[model samples]
Target: MELEAAAALGKYLGAGIACLALAGAGIGVGNVAASFLNGALRNPAAAKEQTATLFIGLAFAEALGIFGLVVAMLLLFAV
Candidate 1:
C-alpha cells in the first residue's frame, strides 16, 4: 500500500511538471504572436509575404504546447 501511494504521488508530480511546461508554452506562444502582429502592423507591405511563415511559427509554438499535453497524458496513462 505504501508503494502504491508513492507511485500515485510520483504520477501527480510528473503531471504537474507537464502542466508547467504547458504554461510556459502558453506564455511563449503569446509572445510570439504579439510580437509578430506588432511587427506586421508597423510594416504591412513587407510582412504580407511573410504571413505564411508567421503562421508556421505560430503552429510550431502551439505544437510545443500540445507536446506538453501529450507528455502529461503519457505520465498519467502510460507510466
Candidate 2:
C-alpha cells in the first residue's frame, strides 16, 4: 500500500513536469516565429526561403510539446 502511494505521488509529480514542458515549447515556438517574421520583413524576396526553415524550427519545437503530452499520457495510463 505504501509503495502504491509512493508510485502514485511520483507519477503525479512527473506529470506536472511534463506539463511544464509545454510552456517551454510554446515560448520556443513563439521565438522561432518572431525571428522568421523579422527576417521576412527585412527581405520580402527571401520569405520563401525563410518559410521552409521556419517550418523546420516549428517541427522541432512542436516535437518537444508532443513528447510532453506523451509523457503526461503515459503517467496517467501506464503508471
Best by TM-score: 2
lDDT of 1 by residue, 1-79 (tens): 6998999999989888888777878897899889888988999888888888778888888899999899889889998
lDDT of each: 0.87, 0.92
Q: Which stretches of candidate 1 lie over 4 Å from their true place?
A: none
Clashing pairs in 1: none
Estimate the overall C-alpha local distance difference test score of candidate 2.
0.92
TM-scores vs. true structure, each candidate: 0.80, 0.83
TM-score: model 1 vs. ground truth: 0.80
RMSD (CA, Å), candidate 1 to true, equals: 1.7
The lowest-lDDT stretch of 10 consecutive residues in candidate 1 is 16-25
Score candidate 1 by lDDT: 0.87
- Could you tell me which 10 consecutive residues in candidate 2 have the lowest summed lDDT? 44-53
**Deviation in angstroms for 36 in model 1?**
1.5
